[model samples]
Target: MIDIQFRREDSNIMSVEMSGHAEAGPYGYDIVCAAVSALSIGTVNSLSEIAEIPVEVVSANDSGGYLKFTLPTDLTQKQMETGQILMKSLYLSLKSTEEEYNEYLRINSLDGK
Candidate 1:
C-alpha cells in the first residue's frame, strides 16, 4: 500500500510525501514512477494559473520507498482550494494505479492458477 500525504505549510507553501511497498523489482520502480509522474502533472496543472512557484523534491529514498516534495509561492484563496483538490485526486490516482499494477504482477507470476 502507498500512503500519500499533503500538507499546507503556510499560505505560500505546500508539501507532499509518498511512501509504499510493492513487489521488489521492476514492478516497484514502475509504481513509483507512475506516482511521481502523476504528481508532477497534477502540481503543474494546479499551479499553472497561479504564480510560478518553486518546486523542490526535498528527498527521495529508493531503499525506503518514499518521496517528499516542497512547493513554495504566494497563491490566491481560490488557487489554494483548487490545489488541495488536485493534490488529493493525484494521490488517489497514484495509489489506485499502484495497487492495480501490483495485482497484475501477482497474477502473472502465478504458474497456472
Candidate 2:
C-alpha cells in the first residue's frame, strides 16, 4: 500500500511525503522508482509551469521507500490550487502503480502453476 500526506505550513508553503511497501516482486523496486521519478519531475514541472512556484524534492529514499517535497513559500491562491492538483496526481499515480504491480504478481503466480 502507498500512502501520501500533504501538509501546508502556510498559504504559500507545503510539504508532501510519500511512503509505501515494495514487496510485490523483483520489479517492485522498479515500479516505486518510476513512480518517484515521475512524481518528482511532475511536481517540479507543474509548480514551475502551472503554478509559477518553485518546488524541490527535499529527500528521497529507495531502501526505505519514501519521498518528500518542499513547496515554494510565496505561492498564491491559484498556486495553492495547482499544488493540490499536483499532489493528488502524485498520490493517484503511486496508488495505481501499486495496484497494477500487485495484479501483475497475482497473474504471474497463476501462470507459474
Candidate 3:
C-alpha cells in the first residue's frame, strides 16, 4: 500500500509527504504508483514553471520510497495563491485515485480540515 500525507497549517497546506510502495502490480507496472509519482513530480514542476515558486523537495535516495514537498517561505502573495491552487489540484487528483483504488492507496490530511 502507498501512504500519502498532507500537512496543513493555518488552513493552508504546508507540505505533502508520500511514502511506501503500492504493490498493486509487479515492478514497472503499478498504475497507482505511477499516478502518484506523476501527480507529485508534475506538481513540483508546475510550481517552478507556472507559479514561479521555488519549493523545497526531498526524495529518498534509498529504496524506501519517500518524497516530501514543502513550500518555501519567501513566496509572494500571488505565488502563494497559485501554489495553493496547484497543490489542491494534486490533493483532489490523489483523492480521486484513492476513491478508485482504496486497497492500494491511502491519503491522510494531518490538519483534518
Candidate 4:
C-alpha cells in the first residue's frame, strides 16, 4: 500500500511524505500508483511555476516508492495563499482516490498535536 503523510502547522500544510508501493496491479500498470504520482508531481509543478514558491523536495534515488517535499517557511502572503490552495487540492484529490482504493492507498495528517 501507499502511505501518505501530510504535516501541518498553524493550520497550513508544512510538508508531505509519501512512501510504499500500491502493488494493486502489475509494476507498470498500477493505477493507484499512477494517480498518486500524477497528483503529487502536478502539485509540485504548480507550486513552483504557478505559486512561485520554493519547496524542498526529496525522492528515493534508486527506488520507486518514496517522495517528500517541505514547503518553505518564508513565502510571501500571496504565495502562501496560492500554495495552500494547491496543497488543499492535492489533499482532496488524494482523499478521493483513497476512498476508492482503500486497500491500496492511505492518507494521514500530522497537525503537531
Against the reference, the lDDT scores of all candidates come to 0.52, 0.59, 0.89, 0.92
Ten residues in sequence with the least summed lDDT for candidate 4: 104-113
Query: For residues 18-111, could you state the per-residue lDDT of candidate 2 as single tens digits?
Result: 6664444466456655655576577777877887777777554546656667776666878888877876666566556646665321111111
TM-score order of candidates, top first: 4, 3, 2, 1
Candidates 1 and 2 compared: the better one by lDDT is: 2
Model 2 lDDT, residue 57, Cα: 71
Model 2, residue pairs in steric clash: none
Compose the digit string of candidate 1's lDDT tens values, residues 25-113.
47546555555555655666455544344456644554755666665556566656766665556556655664666542211111111
**Candidate 3 residue-wise lDDT, 54-77, digit = tens:** 889899977858999999877899
Sum up the clashes in candidate 3: 0
The global Cα lDDT (0 to 1) of model 2 is 0.59
Best by TM-score: 4
Q: Which stretches of model 2 miss by more than 4 angstroms?
A: 1-4, 8-13, 19-29, 60-66, 102-113
What is candidate 4's lDDT per residue for 25-91, written digit by digit as tens?
A: 9988999999999999999999999999988999997987999998999999999999999999999
Cα shift from native, residue 80, model 3 (Å) = 0.2
lDDT value, candidate 1, whole model: 0.52
Give residue 28's lDDT in candidate 1 (0 to 100).
Answer: 40
* TM-scores of the candidates in the order shown: 0.47, 0.56, 0.93, 0.96
Question: On a 0 to 1 TM-score scale, where does candidate 3 land against the true structure?
Answer: 0.93
Query: Residue pairs in steric clash, candidate 3?
Result: none
